[model samples]
Structure formats: C-alpha cells, structure tokens
Target: MNLPELLYALALQHVPNLGDSTARKLIRHCGSAEAVFREKKQNLLKLNGIGKTRIANLQHTAHLKAAEEELKFIEKNGIGVAYFRDQDYPEKLKHCFDGPLLLFYRGNINLQKKKLISIVGTRNITGHGAAFCEELIAGLAPLDPVIVSGFAYGVDITAQRAAVKHGLQTVGCLAHGLNQIYPKAHRKYMAGIEENGGFFTDFWSTDKFDRNNFLKRNRIIAGLSEATIVIESAEKGGSLVTADLANSYNREVFAVPGRPGDIYSKGCNDLIKSQNAHVLTSAADLVYILNWELPSTERAVQKQLFVSLEPEEEIIAEYLQNMGKAELDLIALNCKYPTFKAASVLLNMELKGLIRPLPGKLFELV
Candidate 1:
C-alpha cells in the first residue's frame, strides 16, 4: 500500500465536517496522508475550504485505532484483506468519489482478476423477482464474470448463491464487519463462496449494526461493479437505493418488469418509467451492455479458492474478511450469537494463530 492512500484513508476516518470537497482541499494542501498528519492547525487553514472545527475534528487517534482494529480482526480470522492502497484492491472501486478507505476480504478469488456486475432486489422478494434472479444468474454464469451484491436476504443472496452454484466468483458486499455473516443461514453458501468467490466491507470491527451502514454499503456494491442490475424493488426499497447510488456514480442500473398489482414491482416500474434504470429482460442484455466474455477454466480458478474453514469458522472469517478486524460485539451482531460466545471462539482462534489480537480490544485475521 502507498503511504499517501493509507494515511489519507486512516486520516479521513477521523476527519469530521470534512465533506468531499473539504477532504480534497486537505489532500491537495498536504500532498499526502502522512503530510496531513504532520501539519499543524495553522497549516491546514491555508487549504481553501478547511475550518477550525473540521481541523479540530481531524484526530488521528480514532482513525488509527479503527485501522489497527480492522487489521487485527482480519489477522485473527485468517482471511485476506486489502485497503485502497493495496495492490489487490479492485480497480473499479478505486475511482469512485467516496470509495472506501479500506476493504476487508476473504476467499481465494482474485479481486483484480474478474469484471463485476451487481444484482440487487427487495428483501421481501416476489416469485417473479426470484425467477428473474435465477434466470439472470444462470445466464450470466457461463460468462464467468464476478457477480456483486449486498448479501441481503432477497436478490443479493440469490444472485451470489446462484453464481456459486454455477461455479462463478461472486462478491457480496456487507453492511457490517466481516466477523460474521449476516442473515446467519447464508453461511453455508458464504463459506462456499470463500472457497471460490469472496466478500468485502468498509466499516471498522467496532461499529455496531445500524440502519446507516446499508446505505453506505450499497455505494461500494454499485461503485465496485462495472454495472448494477435491479431484479425487483418496491417504490421505496433498498434495491432502488443501490440503483440511485449507481446512477449518481455514473454506473449503469437495470430493472426487470413486474406484473401489475405487485407492490414490490412499483419500484422497478417507476425506475424504468422515469428512465432511471435500463429495462433488462435477459442475461444477453448484460452481455451486450458490458461486453463480457465466458470464462475459461483457468480464469475461473483464478477468481476463487477452495475453502478449508468450517461453517461457523467461516462466519468469523467472513467478518474479518469484510472489515479486516472486529470486536466480540460486532462479530456477535453479524453472526447472531451472544458476545460471550464470540469471545470464546475468538480466543480459541487467536490461540491457533488464525487471527491476531490488537491493542484497544480488536482482533484481525493473521
């Protein structure tokens, strides 16, 4: 990882009142993350938009603790993780305006190897939506591109599991630390994915599950993918949130038509009608849109790794994979376990050297 991106990433986490524009100003003046941390308040004021509050809010401690915590969690889980500066970080995400400062990961898949397309839909999915997801995934499976999703119960899980079943690498973006898999039951396939595909997340290990995280998580899912496909969404559903983010990022967003009287169909219909999303009726539409090629055996193998972790072990691995580090509580939230139990597992795992303990109560995959 480069010093500039690393420092900027860490520093940005602590920089309050530092909107995108202010952040750019700080970066421009400091020339690098290391330089920014080295500068005094007066020096920061020279930047065009920086103010006293934002400067005061630029405490490196929070960022450092968060970064180190993330690293610790990952080390403990035995999963591989990467930040923006890491060579393995996916290229599609790096250019996004609000791309994550860091990304935790797991599995044997190559982040740099495959092209990405995100598929998303409602948590309360309809039959038509489910059909759309299955058919689309099966169609795209032969092409061998990486499928990206939020790992939410509906279309996201369907797309990811479908890709896995078809022997394609699928990346599921999470709203929480990788310490545990969300929705719990999905761990079976998530473990399967780690052996082949992978997972990614941006939050620190200490952050608890909250409403805001999903909104933030969606951006990366959209930004990381070359394009996004909406299988189904209500008029105001989470899937559309991803579509809007994809559009704001200037990425393509697609929606499938639903039958009339379906409440879940309203979102898709409105998007198509408003011309917010492209009407995608088939995998061919994606193929034509993205110009993807079918993957050879060599390419597919390069995208994923066979897993050795047990189902529960992989749950912890997923947490570390997403945030690169985590605390007991965060792991519990993701895994749906009590914090005390998560601690016991962490202790056992740490003893095995699958993960390493960090200062300030964090653990990361080794």
Candidate 2:
C-alpha cells in the first residue's frame, strides 16, 4: 500500500478501545481506512456494535501521530506488513473473526504453503514432551509443513528447533513487539529461525511488554494454522488457551496424551475426555486426520474385492458412490442415522477398506 493509505490504516488500527473485529466493520462500512476518519460520528454510530466509547477517539490526532511514528519504525527496520484485506495476508487467518488488522513479519517467511501446523505447550517442558515434539516434527518433515509456535523456552523452542533441524520452515509468533525478544536467552536462535521462516506479531514497537500480551498473542498462533497441537500442558497454561482458540476458530486441535496422574498430562487428558480435541499419538495421526498425502504405497487406492458391509455401512457406501464424497452430517442425514452412529459405521467401513476419510470431514468410497 502507498504511504497515505497505510498511514490511515495504521491510524485506524491505533484507535483506543477499537478491536480488529470492530475495526473491520468500520472499514467495510466506510469503504477505506482513510474514509473512516472522514466519516461523521453520527454515521459510524448507525452501525451495530459501534458504540460511542469504541469510536470516541476516532477524531484524536494522537492516533495519527502514533501511526506515523510506527510507520517510520517499520520502514527503518525493513519490516513487512500484511494488511488484513490484502491478498498476502495469511489465508486461514482471514477466516477468523478476530484476526489482526495488520500482521508485521520479518525474515524469509513464506505463507503459500497450505500445510501449517501450530505446536504449543508449557515453558517447563518435560523430557518425554520434548522427545515427542521432536519426533513428531521429524516424522512430518517429509510433508514440508511449516511449523508454528511461540518462541518461548520449552516446548515451543523444542518444536521450532526440530523443524529447523528437519529443514522445514518455522514461524514464531511473538507476544511483544518484533523490536525486542522476550526471555532474552532465546535471542540466539532468532537468526536461524529468520533464515527459513520468520517472526510474526501485531504489537507496535512502542507497546509495553506485559504478561497479559501472551493471551492476545495466543490467538494469532491458533489462527495461522489448519491445526494446533498441544505437546504438553499443565491444567492451565497459555497452550490450553491456544487450543481453545483454535477450536473456537473451527480448526483441528490435537493433544498428546500422557500417563494418568502426570501433572503435565492432565490438560491433554482433560481435553480428550471433554471431546474438545483429538488424541494425537504421532505425526501419522495428524496426517490422516488432515488428509495430507501418505506415502505412495499407503496412498494406493485398492478396491477390496467382494467387500462385505453392514446395513448402515451399505447405505453410506451407496450415498458416497452416488455423491462421490460426503461429509459426516450429510451422510447421517441421507442415510437415516444419527451422526454418532454414522461416524461409527464409517469407521468400520474404513477398516474394511471399503471407504476412506478425507480432509474437512469428508468421506469417499475406496
């Protein structure tokens, strides 16, 4: 974007108490960020959710001055900015209701790859958790998925380092502004991370470093990926919050189950018991659930000759044969079965080699 337009957008973003969702609504209503400033207060209040308090600072000159200063910092630092409305914004994040209005990134990061997986866990990662995290990334290396995580001490660093070791691109979402790195010890790894994939953040250069910022940063980690995996977490942590955010965004969430009574495993077990996340034992589980490509031998579609199916399975098979592919809900509706029952029948059919599961909860005849 040009200087004038970007400045206006940044000013809109800087408006106090105005969030991304509300900002987007105003921008859409006004047609442009520049237009939002020029729009009359009476007109803006007409839109739902645009309360007096939210837009109270719309006319404040301080926001524009702050935007100009931020713009200068961005230019001087050679940072790349992705406007929410632009084509270059992360595609998956675009679907989120509360995604950032603008994303600032640095390094050789690329978003064209469709396979984005987020890995998050406790800062006090256990040995087993670290092993699983590394093994999972190593197993998934062949798919060339972009691994994403907060560049924190434990599980996050383990996953990102493994991704680098495996020659995969990895992105670090920062809770603070890109101008500074938290847990200063992590600074050493920044160069390697930027060499392949880089850092992403929405915080301005002047934003304060606060513990509360991590909660807001969690949303970006959850929003950027097709799935978020919790390697290990206590009963409560930022990683669990990220899992919840991913579920809220309708993205897949996976948790690695640990032994019973294990403090760190409690969170994962709870998530699975509540049916909020899928139990992830290995990378293969993620691959199958996401419908990523398998090895050629495993991917070969061999029809099971004279395959036998139960009555419900037969009904589903016929539906898929006619429809080519059908989602679980549709299969249940057309086959006169409850959704859970349909899922069970489909699982049997899959084991029988009569059908297969696909991404987006779709199923098809083998």
Candidate 3:
C-alpha cells in the first residue's frame, strides 16, 4: 500500500506532550519529521521544554505497530491522509501555531474555496428555526461555496446536508479520527458525504475520542474555512467556541437573530447584539455585505417557482410576518400542531434559524 507523509506524521502525533507547535519547532531545528524519529533521546531532550519525560514518552515511536494498524483501517476504507509538511495541506491553516499535523480525509469536497463558511447550532432545534435554516441554505445554495462543520447534530447536519443537496461541496471536520463516526446514526450519510466529497479527520483509530481533542478540532474548523456561521446556539458550548476562534483568526462571523426569550436563539442574538457578528437576515444580506460573487448556476435558480412552504406553513409564515410577532401557541394554532409538536417543529426551524422567539413563546418571521 502507498502511504502518505502523514503516515509518518502520525508517529509524532502518537507521541504524548509533543504537539504540532513543538513538533514543528523540533522539525525546524532538526529538519524533517524523520530526523526527529532518528535522534537520540539525549539530543531530543536538549531542546527547550523537551523534558526528559517527553523524550522518554516519545521513544515509544518504536511501538508504531499500533499506529500502523490505525492507518491500515483507514486505508482499507480508501480514505486519504494529509500532513502539514505535504503540499496538499491547506495553505491558510498551515501558519496557525497549533494547527493539526495531519488530517484524514474521506470526502471528495473542496477544502479550498474562494470563501468557506462554518454552520453550527444546538442539537435541539425548532421547526420555525429549521425553516430559517432551509432558507439560509437555499439562499446560499447557489453560491457553490464550501460549507464546513463538525458532523454532530442540529445546525451542523442541516448545513452539510443542505449544501450537498444543493450540489455544493461540504467538508465535515471531525473531532475524532476517521476510524469511526461518533454519533453512529450519521454513518450512512457520512459515507454519502465521502461519495459526494467531504473529508474527515487526522488522528489514528486507536486515539480514543477525547474531550480536549474536540477543542483542538475547532481551531481547524475555524482555520480551514474563510468564515463561520452560527445557526442556533444556546448561550454556551461548541458553536460559541467556533465563533470565538473564527474571530480570533479574523474571519467573518455571521449570526442569525432569535427571539428575546427563546433559549436557543439567545446565543446568536447575543453575538450580534454584542457586535461579535454582523447581523444577517437573509443570504441576500450576506451576499451584499460581503459583495460575494455568486455562481452562475445558483443565480439562475434563485427565483422561487412555488412557495416552498405547505399550505399551513404559508399561513404561519404569513401570520408571523403580519403580526410582526406572536407566541408559540398562536403560531401553533395556525400550523395545526399541538403546542408540544409545534414546539418541536419550531425548534427544528429555529435550528435552521427561520424566526426569532420573543419573551412569551412569540415568534417573528425573520
């Protein structure tokens, strides 16, 4: 089997306490990943912070049979591996201090785009919010831009699925290595992503999923993409972390607004209200602000032939638009769902980020 540079990069990756930054430093001083492997323990420990413990731990490179097994698993699946020192590593992400030393990609999507955006939100979403997500995805659909996100739940899935449905490349940035899909439910879909062109992660199969690894994964999501989009975040967690990192990297941050009282919407509205994000009401809003150059095919398909909404959906959308705002109960009556079912639908829509909820279950069409 033909192995890539990252196969060896995984050697350094398997070493404890020897991160990308330190690895890069070692490579800069010593030259090449192979040299680091060939060096004696005393020589490795001579470098700054290359403590005795780190060197001793790294000597375990001799036990690469496990790493080899990990590589075999991914290779068996025909997945691709990328390393920072290789020409295929993303140019934009290479400069980041703690960027990944290697990535395991399974999809056919384009990591390089004139503009890339990340979409993420809560696992629990609203139908109203989902509608908004659909609209946003539909609006942005024509642009042919690469969409990047963690392959978790809610907004992330929505954005990736929508992008693929619209014939755009979507890259799923994974927290764990390509060894397995975390949620497991999305395996079939993730396989479809690989078929259509979305890549996976960098770690070896044996690198059991870890919490800190997820945090490290976020930087790559932010670094690889050109901008970040928060569809529906609660006031805390992963989506917020992505937004913060994107801003730190000076990438554009866009947030859809939510209602005053809706818990899910609070994060997005707050980000905009706090000036961490530019407010985006529609794809048009984003296109205009960014002066985006839309793909020709997408522009041709922009006109809505029929209202994509169902009869009751149109009524609810119209009702929300006319009332300027109404609580979930009032909207529920309009949509034929019991309050509970209606709420579920609304959460899905909210994840899509369609309408913002107000203080008393009130929702206003965005």
Cα RMSD (angstroms) for every candidate in the order listed: 18.0, 10.0, 8.0
State in Å the error of residue 273, model 1.
Answer: 0.5
Query: TM-score of each candidate?
Result: 0.73, 0.81, 0.76
For candidate 2, report its TM-score.
Answer: 0.81
Compute the lDDT of residue 337 as modeled in candidate 2. Answer: 73
After superposition of all CA atoms, the RMSD between model 1 and the true structure is: 18.0
lDDT of 3 by residue, 228-298 (tens): 88888888878888899888888888888878899998999989989999876566556656777645443
Candidate 2 per-residue lDDT, tens place, 1-366, comes to 677878988998899889899898888999888999999999998999888887788988999999999999999999999999898899999999999999999999888955999999999999889877876886677678999999999999999999999889999999988899987999999999999999999999999999999999999999999999999989999999999999999999999898889999989999999999998866656877897764454345466667666687778888999999998889878999745456656654665557788988898987
Candidate 2 colliding pairs:
none
Candidate order, TM-score descending: 2, 3, 1
| 201: Cα error in model 1, Å | 0.6
lDDT (Cα, 0-100) at 30 in candidate 1: 79
lDDT, each prediction: 0.73, 0.88, 0.72
- 68 Cα displacement, candidate 1 (Å): 4.0
Lowest summed lDDT across 10 adjacent residues in model 3 is found at 298-307
Question: Candidates ranked by lDDT, best first?
Answer: 2, 1, 3
